[model samples]
Target: MTTDNRSTLFSPLTLPTPDGTGFALRNRTILSPMCQYAVDRQDGVATDWHLQHYGAVAAGGFGLLTIESTGVNAAGRISPRDLGMYNETQEAAHRRLVSFIHSQGAAAAVQLNHAGGRASGKPWLPGTHGGSAPLEDGGWQTVGMTDQSIAKGYRPTTKLSKDGIEQIVSDFAAAARRADAAGYDVIQIHAAHGYLLHQSLSPLTNTRDDKYGGTEENRFRLTREVVDAVRAAWPDSKPLGIRISATDWVAGGLDVDVTSRLMRDLVKNHGINWVDVSSGGLVSTPLQPSGPGFHAVLGAQIKRALADTDAVVSVVGGISSPEQAETMLRTGQVDAVSIGRAAMRNPHWPAMAAARLGVPCEDNPAAPQYWRAEW
Candidate 1:
């Protein structure tokens, strides 16, 4: 196969940045951010485990690797072991990781998140899958849009006051500054999976009568503010992106139509350059579909909705097979595919997929040292 004959999955994608100069990705495959929960000291700093873990994926040929959920504040972490972007120590560690990823010919992105009511929970490692970590075990009270539990085993959260909400926005902006300092190519604001921003977006979670809740526009206030703040803080040369659960999968909850509108506005008016679509984290419901390429349709809809803009749309689900991913891209379902568990199972997934898709070996995105490794 020749370069011109290469599959869309192996082709480059340039994401538009605020500066008008685009951020070029070597290929269309992105490594979805997955939590490792390996921070030994629980101080929210990246450790050796993080370096090796992300390094492996970078060398594995991903065009972009999104670092897992990182807290903007200590109390906002999903687990004590999750990463944070607030301090000098964490920022330095992240810089080290980004340098290594770039050396391997990959771009690095960090997902800035505030888990809200879901914070301070047990890591999802074996034998400690669910429930909030007790205070004695280093857990703290979580905060949310309302004083409610996001899930059954999670602790009930304190409702965030107007001041608290403002603080949250400030924290995200501060984190964005740190991310730029760390030399990240992109910053993904995590508004999905029932986090603080998602809580405010979903009617099932946000019931406040204040300006930050109730009507759809009011519910969207916090996320919009955070986006504005981060965009203002972050350098215009780097692209800004977001991960959103396109649907809540239950009646009277957020769905594709609403989220599509949000994406359009974010791309057209705000400074978002990319959107990664996922769904159903506010509450567990059977209505949420499952299986391979589950979020492809939603991604396509959002892509079509943002057709007039230069925003790139990606989808994450059971997108394991190379053929399925290729078909999705070839059919214009999404601009890119975010591989999760499959990438974990095989860190060199992109390299192998490139070979399977018949991309010429010289053009394969694999690290130079791995070029001789038979795919």
Candidate 2:
């Protein structure tokens, strides 16, 4: 295949760093952070399963691998088995994973998160599909922006006090520092999917009357603080990013227009260099669109909104096809496409996508050992 025939999906991208030189990616394919919930013990450490799971994806050819929703503190974890970044042991384990990802010629990012009202839930695995885990089963009390339960099956949360919010901010900063120590090339603050930050962002979830709630400015306060804290703790030379749910897919909830303004502010005012657009995790609703490239329209809206800024906008949600991804980039829908369930089904989705898109065999991003197997 000639260079002119090469797809934009296989093109290199540079996410700007504070230093202005920018961080380079081999391609526009990013592995969306997906929880594995494979930690055998509830110690908040990355296990061998994580190493192998992420290592395979790194070698499979993703330009960047965003690790799953990692807890900034023990209580912030989504489940007892979820990974955490608050302690030295977790930091060291993360360092090991980053080393292997770098060895595979891919950049590594950690999605630092606090589940808030969604914490202490059972893993989304067999038998325990969803809902809160019991106290005897290792679940603990959850905290959130309000005292209400996020969903019917989830436990009601203790509303975070002003001091508690301060502590959560500190925990995020400490986790950012640990991520830097672990040699991660990027830090993606997880503000989406109805987690702590998202819980604070949406009007449906945040009914508080304090400075952290009420008006739009107040709803956005916690996210801004988290971004500022993470940026301060992370290296200036490394890019800082965020993942946000663009809409709640319901009335009186966040919509693209609202989130686009938020993304613009985050990119222009804050130090965020990348924005990964996703939607409808704040609450379960049938209104959330599905099918191939469902979030591309939302991403396009955000990209146009942030046209004046240098932020890279990527979208995730049912983006599985190479042609579909190429069409999105070629048509200026999004800067990149984040592969989730598709990548899980085939870790080497990028390599296969490259071949399908007419990229030369030599230029394919597959592991050398597996290159012999035809795409």
Full-model lDDT for every candidate: 0.93, 0.92
Q: lDDT by residue for model 2 over 1-375, one digit each (tens)? A: 124556899899999998898999999999999999887889889999999999999988999999999999999999999999988999999999999999998999999999999999996657865678999988999999999999878999999999999999999999999999999999999989889999999999999999999999999999999999889898889999999999999999999999998888889888999999999887889998999889988999999999888899999999998999998998888898899999999999999999999999998988898898899
Error of 1 at 133 (Å): 0.9
What is the Å distance of residue 203 in model 1 from its true position?
0.3
Measured with C-alpha atoms, the lDDT of residue 166 in candidate 2 is 94
lDDT measured at residue 67 in model 1 versus the true structure, 0 to 100: 98
Clashing pairs in 1: none
* Model 1 lDDT per residue over 1-375, tens place: 123455999889999998999999999999998989988888989999999999999998999999999999998999999999999999999999999999999999999999999899996657877679999988999999999898888999999999999999999999999999999999999999888899999999999999998999999899999999999999999999999999999989999999998988888888999999999888889888879998999999999999999999999999999999999998888999999999989999999999999988999888899999988
